[model samples]
Target: MATRTIIVPEGMEFIRDELGYAPAVRVEQRLYIAGQIGRGSDRQLVADKEAQFTQVFENLRQVLEAAGAGFEHLVEVTSYLTDMRDLPLYMQVRDRYMAGCYPAWTAIGAASLCGAPGYFLEVKAIAELD
Candidate 1:
């Protein structure tokens, strides 16, 4: 197997602009994704927290699929939050995506995020796939 870095510049400019990393990387059959946020296809942060968390997972799903993988392949995840108080809501939406398979996870409480207000949470994932 070979390692690869995938940059979806056609739709995601913030990868280089904000994080200075490619959108995703494949290494030895695993995909280590950069941090994904609650942004839409239009690249704007959804104003609602539940919607934002939903969008973030959707965005991560897209990246995983782009790398030929799926949610069950995720082995680890790192989550950041501008407001830890929103974790319940975040987890509600997150559980819907995770389907009871809990990956190794780390969460940090933060003062703010890169985008607009109400942008409560951000998360990145590492996936093992074929």
Candidate 2:
């Protein structure tokens, strides 16, 4: 299968050249998204946990949309959090965006994330298109 990089708009291509990875890569019917942080369009980390969480999902949405997919196409998700105490809040924000379409999920607690120090969480996803 041929692999293609999903083109991201300016200021949002966080991983392409910096991390040596495409923000999202499409291979046939599958779209693999890199871990998304809570950074705003300005490329700065959001301070509030809920706000940051929302931004993370928004970032994911952008990549999916670029690849002609949506939340419904998501098959799996992996999240990394700086604190497990934020799990409840994270789930609440996640449910708000995810609605009833559930996907396989895994959450991990990490000592720190790469990027801004205020970043509390990051999310990675896999989506399958029909």
Q: In order, how many clashes per candidate?
A: 0, 0
Q: What lDDT would each prediction earn against the true structure? A: 0.82, 0.87
- Candidate that scores best on TM-score: 2
State residue 17's C-alpha deviation in candidate 2, in Å.
3.7
Cα deviation of 23 in candidate 1 (Å)?
A: 1.1
Residue lDDT tens for model 2, 22-82:
8887888888898999988887789998999999999988888888888999999999999
TM-score of every candidate relative to the true structure? 0.86, 0.91
Off by over 4 Å in 2: none
Candidate 1 residues lying further than 4 Å off, grouped into runs, are 7-10, 13-20
Candidate 1: C-alpha lDDT: 0.82
lDDT tens digits, residue span 7-117, model 1: 453467667677677888777777889888888988777987788889998988888877777789999999999978887887888888898777999989988887556
| Model 2 residue 125 CA deviation in Å | 0.5
* Clashing residue pairs, backbone N/CA/C < 3 A, model 2: none
